[model samples]
Target: MKTGKKVVILLEAVLAVLVLAAVVLMLQGKNGQDMVKVSVIIQNSDDTQWAAFKYGLKMAAEDQGIEVYIANTGETLTVEEEKSLIEWEISNGADAVIVRPVPEEGAEEMLKKFEKRIPVMLVGSTASKDRSLSALPVTESDNYAMGTALAEELLKDYNNSVEGKTIGIVSETGELESVMNREKGFRDRLLNTGIQILWSVTNRSGEPKENLPADQPEVNFVAALDNNSLTAAGEEAAANNLHGAIVYGIGHSTEAVYYLDTGNVKCLVVPDEFNIGYQSLTEISESLRRFFHKVQDKAVSHTVLRRETLFTKENQEIIFTMSQ
Candidate 1:
């Protein structure tokens, strides 16, 4: 009887030890053993702006010891597709999400649903003024200020006189608030300058140079407010031999730098996309460390690059590239 009792006690002790070891392993898996995952969704995957942003994000993720998953919604910018990607990320146990939404009617509602479960950060755009989304954080450029500054600088080249001078404006579809605000700011600043806005084209892709009336007053300047527009205008100017027509615009891409170097483009307003990506991820990591409520409405800076300042060796890094 004594021997049997001793045997039973030994078995119980072994079972307790095994249970304790299993609990420890489980805790480690939940805490230190696994990496925290972050999901990033971009509206347009092919854009140079997002390319820079992704570079910053990946660098930050490496520094922070975290995992980042990215998805591109293509050029259509469909809200449903964005929501589907977010849903998949959430279902797969992503701890947080960074998104550049399409700003459609249902976008807010869809984001709010995700916010209830995990942290969501906005990039290149802001959520609506809805009180419910006020807690969401955003990282983007001040488009209005950038536009106003670009116009002011361009005016200097014309001796601040609109007398017999015509400027062409190239912009996006004007459906986005950022594009609209930029156009508005530029137009408002040029209102008193008497510079006639000969034409405002809504197409941002391909060469719209043909749209510039051949018989109209000489176009003293052409301004493109987005990346695609900038490229189109620069190429058009170079191809058609449009001399003395300064092409100024917004964006920082390899092509933009090329145009600047070749003298096809005069000035470019480049937003700090690298910083935007870096900061957004860093902020999201902090939120994971403490509480999600820690990060809110954050803005990045924009730089204006001119032909004379672009190749000075000091400004080579101003343009954002995938390899950089």
Candidate 2:
């Protein structure tokens, strides 16, 4: 009888352990379903352009009831660092990932790996060569169109006459596809305008007032391709009193607006950064819900912000609030 009793006790103990294990697993599964997690990784997180984008991400995350993890690499990022962060996110059970990948070798392979694990929403430039990743959903401005538009606007000042006129092009880096495209668009648009490109210099170090071309003839216009170049060109123009030369560039920062107000910059091509952030998160959320089968590919539109329109009541409020 004691032997039979011992057998029964062992069976009961085993049953209890199985029940406990099942309950623990059930709890873990429930917790996993309760909250969707997303990770957003950005290169150059210190840039002011990301402020609106971050705000938009937070707002969308709160609205969607999802947890967000943000990783900002303060400097230019590399492929290895990007892969490490992505692996960490995957291990942490991130449901989706939004990243602005640095253009480098193996970027395409890394993105393919990310797509296999979780839905990826790209921002800024498409880091892939051959445009194979063009089908991926991305939130970015039409940089080429922005450059072309800026050139068109500049030409209006000269009454469409480019004869005997020189234009200087300043940019951050040639390594970036966006910068290259913008410069290319601008140059191509002016190909038949009889205007001369004084020089195109890459100022990655961002030295203030040092972006201007040396030994160049008097430039009728200066085209700064990015925010840093824009500021540098503006400062140089202001300090040198180049009032005859119209300086313009692409940026949406308060400093860019300040340059406009001070007559340092003539026109600014501003992309809706807030929309980019908001749309990226919203799309990621939808992708998570729908298994990433329905996200659409599109580019955010760019706006030409002149001084008159920039200081308008609505724009003024937006600029003030964004600066804060």
Candidate 3:
């Protein structure tokens, strides 16, 4: 009888211990469940490239259980206005802020304003050092490599150099670095190989500026930098009867690939934009972990991951289908 009583007491003690352990585990999990809040401000979220980027960010956030707030800088926001938005996010207790600045120079002021309070990461464009902004996380595609690839594809059909041969660049008026840099790369290679840039037109709208020289273009090429600029360039190309002029778009926007399929554009070059968006969020999460000391991963330095691929008429079918 005593043995039976002792066995019952032992079982009750074990049950009591199990209940206490469950309660402690529940409390600990509750403590660790703090939601990380992140703010992402793109230059303009309405643009296709920005939309794609936001999609990538949202996917990552959903997987990681992060809270993200997205805002657009508007079509005509000034540097001061951009800064005000950043300040507002910081004031509202954002743990980190990722921004695509309206103007490259404008980033410096915003970075100076918020660096000490929270980490600032930039997407889309390059920034000056004074801004204290992290290097844009996307891989810097070798614009020159892209230019070289285009040249090689162009050479496959024609033996003559592009030097002194007129080409037209329909680019953003200003404030877009990636486009300008890619254009420079194209110009450098073509000029070295004997090509002349007849006239470069700057467009604010997705429309072509009326001021481009009307001389007969020998092999006019369109270099659209962003999604908006790319659309405007396409419209201008179709309107201007540049239908078969060896075009090569830099960003992998759907429109850019569509042009290649329709034979409106001869070539396309794209960076790993999907990877860029995915990596940026992963890095942001890691940064948050470092700052909050919730995880033991060491803080990583600024990383620039640049990847580029050349798409041509021959491989347009395979290439265009990947992004969608």
| Highest TM-score against the true fold, candidate | 2
Local accuracy by lDDT, each model:
0.75, 0.76, 0.56
**Residue 272 deviation, candidate 1, in Å?**
0.5
Candidate 2 vs candidate 3: the lDDT winner is 2
Tens digit of per-residue lDDT, candidate 3, span 258-296: 555565555555555554455567667776655442211
Give a tens-digit lDDT track for model 2, residues 173-193. 776667777887888888889
What candidate 1 gets wrong by more than 4 Å, as runs, is 1-30, 127-135, 204-218, 241-245, 320-322
Residue-level lDDT tens digits of model 1 in 114-204 = 8877778988766553423444678888878888988988887767876667888876556555677678778888987778887776763
lDDT of 1: 0.75
**By how many angstroms RMSD does model 1 differ from the true structure?**
7.3
After best superposition, candidate 2 residue 217: deviation in angstroms?
A: 6.3
With candidate 2 superimposed using the best TM-score fit, by how many Å does residue 139's alpha carbon deviate from the native? 1.1
What RMSD does each model have against the real structure? 7.3, 7.5, 9.5
TM-score for all predictions?
Answer: 0.80, 0.81, 0.70
Displacement of the residue 105 alpha carbon in candidate 3, Å: 3.0
Candidate 1: pairs in clash: none
